[model samples]
Target chain A: MKILLYIILVTILLATSSARYGVVAQQSKVREYRIANEHRILEEFVTLLSIPNVASDHVNIRRNAALIIEMMRRRGLEPRLLEAGNSVPPAIYGEWKVPGATRTIILYAHYDGQPTDPKQWAGTMPWQPTLRSAALEAGGTILSMPKPGEKIDPEWRLYARSASDDKAGVMAILTAVDALKAQGIAPTSNVKFFFEGEEEAGSSHLGDIIRDQKLLEADAWLICDGPVHQSGLKQVVFGVRGDTNVDLTVYGAKRPLHSGHYGNWSPNPGLILAKLLSSMKDEAGRVTIAGWYDDVAPLGETERRAIEEAPHYDNELKTQLGLARTENAGKSLLELINEPSLNINGMSSGDVGALARNVIPTTASAVLDLRLVKGT
Target chain B: MKILLYIILVTILLATSSARYGVVAQQSKVREYRIANEHRILEEFVTLLSIPNVASDHVNIRRNAALIIEMMRRRGLEPRLLEAGNSVPPAIYGEWKVPGATRTIILYAHYDGQPTDPKQWAGTMPWQPTLRSAALEAGGTILSMPKPGEKIDPEWRLYARSASDDKAGVMAILTAVDALKAQGIAPTSNVKFFFEGEEEAGSSHLGDIIRDQKLLEADAWLICDGPVHQSGLKQVVFGVRGDTNVDLTVYGAKRPLHSGHYGNWSPNPGLILAKLLSSMKDEAGRVTIAGWYDDVAPLGETERRAIEEAPHYDNELKTQLGLARTENAGKSLLELINEPSLNINGMSSGDVGALARNVIPTTASAVLDLRLVKGT
Candidate 1:
C-alpha cells in the first residue's frame, strides 16, 4: 500500500512539475513519511480491502462507503457522502485546502469493485485479501500479515477482487494525502478528493451526482484508475471511448414447433437473429451497419501524434493473451480505440447443451455493447 | 375409434380395387363389423393409449409393445416381439397368411408417440385419453366413455398424445384386420403386421432391428400415418422428406470477459455463429451453403402432376397460421417440399433474458435440422 501510494503520487507530481528541484524534495519527503508509517498504511488498506464493495450490493457497499468516510475523517478532510438517490451508491466527497492556493486539483478515484463470482477466483475468494510473496503465477506462497517490527516486502502481492482495481486507487489517493500532511508540505494547489462508489457499475448516475452536489469545481480532474503503461511507466490517457449497451431480440412462431414437421416452413428465430447480427459486421471484422461510422469525429493533430508516439505493443499484447491474430485492418489498438466498436456481449435461444431439444425456439435475444468516440 | 377405422379401411380398399363392386361390398361388411363391435374395439384402443408411449421412456414404451403383442395374440395372429437390443424399444411383429395368395402386404404403423409435455395439452393429459363431443377449439365438452350397449358417436374427438399420429395408425390397422376376420372375409393378399416402437426418436436403431430380424420381407408396405387431405378426402402421399439433425458449436475466448475492457478486441462466438449461419441462406430463404442443393433429384412427370393437382391451400394455410407472407420465392409448399431444406432447430450462447450481463460469452451453439427429398 505504501509503495502504491508513492507511485500514484509520483504520477501526479511528474505531471505538475513547476520546479524540478522543488518537486524532487517534496517527493523525497512523501517517500520518507510512507517508509516510516508503512505498517499503519498497510493496516488501513487491509481494513478497507476486507469490506465487500460490489456497487450493486447495497448493504456491503454502504459499509464500504462508511469505512472510507471514517478514514477520510481521520485525515482531517471533512468527508461527506454525496448521495445520488435512495438506491444509488454515494460518492465520498472531501477537500484538503491549502493556504493561498492558486488552483484546485480534484484527485479522482473510485471505492467500488466489479461484481465477481467467488468460485472463479484461483485459490482465494474475491473479498478475502491474501498476501503473497509474489504473484500467484510466479509461485507465490500465501503468508500472514507482518508483525509491527517484522520486515514487510513492498513486492508482495495482495489477492482480492478490487485489490488492484478502483479500491487500490482509493487506497493510494488517501495514503498520498496522509504522506503529504505528515511531511508538512505547503504552498501546493488545494486538492479535492472525489472517490466514486459506482464507477465499476459503469457510473450510470455519475453525471447526476456531480450536477446535484455541485462540489466538483476544479482546475483539472486526475483519475487514479486503469492500468499503468505496458512499458512499466505511468499511463496518462487523454480520453477514453464512451461505453453503452443495448438488448436485441428477434421473434419466430408464437410457440416451439417440431423441426421436422415444420423446419424451413416455419421460420427459426435463431437463424433470424443470426442473419440480423451477421448483417451488422463484414468478413474483415468491420461494422457494415449503414452510416455507423459517419458521426465519428477524426483524431486531432496532437491526438494523432500521441497515438504515433505510443508503444508498438500490439504483438506483445496478442502474445500475452495467447491469440494467434487480432481484428486488425491496418490499425493499432491506440488508433482503433479512437473509433467506434460494436460487440455481442451475450446471446441465447432455446438450449445448447444436454438439455437442448429438437424444437424450433420461439425467440432469440442478444446483448450488444457499443463503444463510441467523440460524436458517435 | 369406429369412424376412424372405417375411414382408414375405406382408404385401403379404395387403393387396392381389382373390381369396384367387390371393394364396395367388402367395405360394407367391414363397416357392419365395426358398428357391432364398437365397444370392444374402443376398449382395446383405450388400453393401448393409456400407456405413456414417449419413445425415450424405456419402461412405458416396452409396456405399449407388450400390450400390442397381447392384442395380436387374442386375434390368433401368432404375435412376437422383435427386440431392438437393450435400452431400445422393441417392435411388435405378427402375420396372417392366406392360402393361394401370390403377394404379401405389410401393414406398417408406429406404437411409440412423440415426447410430449402434458402441461401444453388443454383440459387433458398426454396419456389420459379423454373423449369430447367436438374438437377442443370448437368448444368441445368432456364426455364420459359410453356404457355397454349405449350408442357411440363416431365423430366425438378422443384426445391423447399420438391420438392422431401413428398410434391411431396402430389402432386403425389392427381393428381393420379384426373386422375382416369377424365378417369371415380373407384379404386377397397375405398380410403382415409391423408395429414400430420408436419412430418418433428419428428411428436411429430401426435399420439395425430390421437387418437383425430379417422378417420384414414383403411386396408392399402400407404405412398408416400422416393426415388426410385439406379437401377432406383420405390422403395418399407417395413420399415424404427425409429428416436428420446436426449440432453446431462456435468458439470464443476461453473465459467470459468484461465487454468494456475487451469488447471488439476479442471475437464474440455469438457473432461468429451468426455470420456462419447467415451465410447458409439468403433473403428469399434459399440455403446458400455451397453445393447444398447439388445432389437433389428432380421430380418425375407423375410427381409434378400430383403437385399441380394438389389443392393450392397456401394462402389459407398462411392465414390459419397467422402469417402475412410465406417464404415463397416462386414455388408453393408442395414444390418446396420436393427440395432439401435447412433449419435451425435451436441455438444458444449466454444469458439473453433477465440474467444477461455485460460479458462476452465463451461459446455459441445451434442445432440444425436438414430435410431431404429424393436424393438430397
Candidate 2:
C-alpha cells in the first residue's frame, strides 16, 4: 500500500512540474514584450501611481478609476465602472473575448492602495513614484526617472506606497494584455479584467457590486496580487491562506497612573496584554490554544510529496532575514505555511524611546492576523 | 518560638504607630497655618508653575532657580545659587539656623519639570497653571484663580505639568517653614533647603555641585518628590527601590514586508519580542529568569513586622483597579514591592488601531525597567 502511494505521489509531482514549465514558457514571451516597452510601461505605471488611491479618499479614488478606464479603452477593451451605489468606489470592468475559447478567466486586481503616513516613508514621498538603484535596504540611492529610450534595470525598485501592492497587480495584468496584443498572440481562454477600487478597505461593498453586475461569470479567477516568492522565483499558488483580523485591547487603570507610586499594585495593561498574547503561542511558536490544530485537515500524499520536492532554501532565507533560527525548530517553511498561522500585525502600549513616560498606560492594544489554510 | 516572635512583632508595631501619632500632632499646627493663608500660598505656587522649567530650557530653568532663591530670602533665610560651572542648571541653596538645635536636616526637591508636549495637556496648557474643581479624570471644570482674601477649597486641583511632582514638594516645604515662623514654633532641627534645577535631566551635575559646596552636610536628607499613597493615608517610605532601565530591540526583515506575503515565513519582530518577554515571566507573573529573584534580600524582623501591621487593602485596591487577579497569587502588594521586579515601561511595534497596516515591522522595541529592592 505504501509503495503504491509513493508511486502515485511521484506521478502527481511530475505532472505538476510539467504544467508549471508550460506556464514559464508563456511568461517568457510576456517578458520579452515587457522588456521592449519598459520605458513606456514604467511611465504609464508611474502616472497611475501619482494619484492617491486611499479608499476613503472618494475624489482621488474616482480619479484612479477614471485613469484605469482610459488605459483599458486605449487597448480597445471597452471598460465600464460597476458600482452598487454612488456612495461606493466602482470596480473597473473590461473584457477580451478569445474566439473559440473553452473557458473564461477573470483577472483580479485592485487600484486602491492602503492608507499610509507619508512621514514614515524615507526620502521619497508615497504618491511620487521614484526609482531606486536597488532595494532601500541595500543602501539604494534615488535615481532620476529614466529619459525616453534610456535603459532601465529590472532590479531597480520603484518606491511608492502601492508600488508592489494591489496597484502593481493592476499594472502587471493590464501590461500582460498589452504585451499579448502587441505580439499578436491570442490567449487560449477568454480574459476578463476586473480592477477593484477598495480591496485595501476590506472590500466591504464587493459582494454588493458583484451581485448587481450579472455579467461577472467566469470559470476561474487569477488574483494578480501579493508578492512573488521570497527567492524571486515565480510560483503558482493553487490556494491562498484565508485571513481574518482581530483587534484586541486590554484595560488597566481608568487613567494613567504614576508607575513609581503604583508600579506593583496597579496592573499594567501592557504586561497584561503581553501575558495574554504569550498564552496563545508556545516556545516552538505553535498556537497552544485548544482546538487550534484540531480542525486542520491533513495533507494528501500528493501535497506532501510536492512539499518534499520543493527547493530547501530556509538557510538562505534565514541569512537574508538576519535570523539564526526559525519559529519551528525542524519544520520547513513550506510545511509551516500549509498550516494555520497567527501573526501580530501590530502591537503598542504607551510610548517607547524618548517619548516614554513613567506611567501605567490606560490601555494596550494589538492587531492580530490569523491566516488559515484550505480546509482549516 | 513562633509565639515569642509574634509577641516581639506586636511590640515593634505599637512603637512605630506611637511615633507616627506624634508626628501627626506636630503637623496640626502646620496644617492650621496652611489653611489660613491658602489663597496666598496658592498664588505663589501658581506663579512659580507659570514658568517653563524643562532643564534644557536654559533661560527658563535659571528663572525658576532665581524665583526659588527669592522665595527663600523672603523667609529670612539667606539663599545662593550653587553650580559646578556655567554649563549646567544651578541648584538653589538656603539655610535657616535654629538656635540650640541638636541636628540639621536637608530638605531636597527639584524646581525643574520633565519635558512635556503641550498638545498632550487637555483643555489646559502645560506651563499655564490652571485651577480645576477636581482632577480632569473626574470631569472637573476650569475655575478662575482665587482673588485676595477669597476662600480657596483645599480639594480644588491645580492643573500643570509639574503640579503634583517635585514642585508640590517645593511648595509644601516652604509653606511649612512659613507656618513655623508665623506660629513662633521652632522645628526640632535646623533646616537646610536644597532645590535642584535639573533633577528631570538626571542630576548629572548634582555630585559636582555637592562636592564644590562643603556646607551640604546634614544629619538627615529628606527627599520630597513622587506621589502620595494610593490609599490616601499618610505614610513614610524608606530606602527607595533602585532603578535600572534597559532598551531592547528585536529585528525582523531589514525592510517591512507585506503580512500576507511574508508572515509566518519571515520572523515577526513583534511576535519574536513577545515570545522573548513571555519567557521571562510565568503564569503567576513571577519572573522566571535564571537569577531574577536570587539577589533579593530577606527583610529584617522590624521590616517584616511593619509589613504585617500595614493595612490589608489589596482587595479594595483590586476592586478599584478592576483587576480580578494580581501577580504572585497570595502575596500582598507590600510583600511584592519588597522584592525585585521587572516591568515593561513602554513597548511598540508598527502601529495599532486605524493606522495599523498589514505589514511585518522591521523592528520592535521595548523599554524595560528593573526595580531593585534594598541589598539586591
Q: Individual DockQ of the candidates? A: 0.33, 0.40
What is the lDDT, from 0 to 100, of the residue A309 in candidate 1? 89
Best by lDDT: 1
Q: List runs of model 2 lying over 4 Å from the truth.
A: A1-36, A85-87, A183-186, A305-309, B1-32, B52-63, B73-76, B84-89, B114-122, B147-150, B181-188, B197-205, B308-312
Compute the DockQ of candidate 2: 0.40
Interface RMSD of every candidate?
Answer: 2.7, 2.0
lDDT of 2 by residue, A107-178 (tens): 788999877888888999999999899878898899999898888887788888787776877777777667
Candidate 1, after superposition: displacement of residue A308 in Å?
2.5
| Top TM-score prediction, candidate number | 2
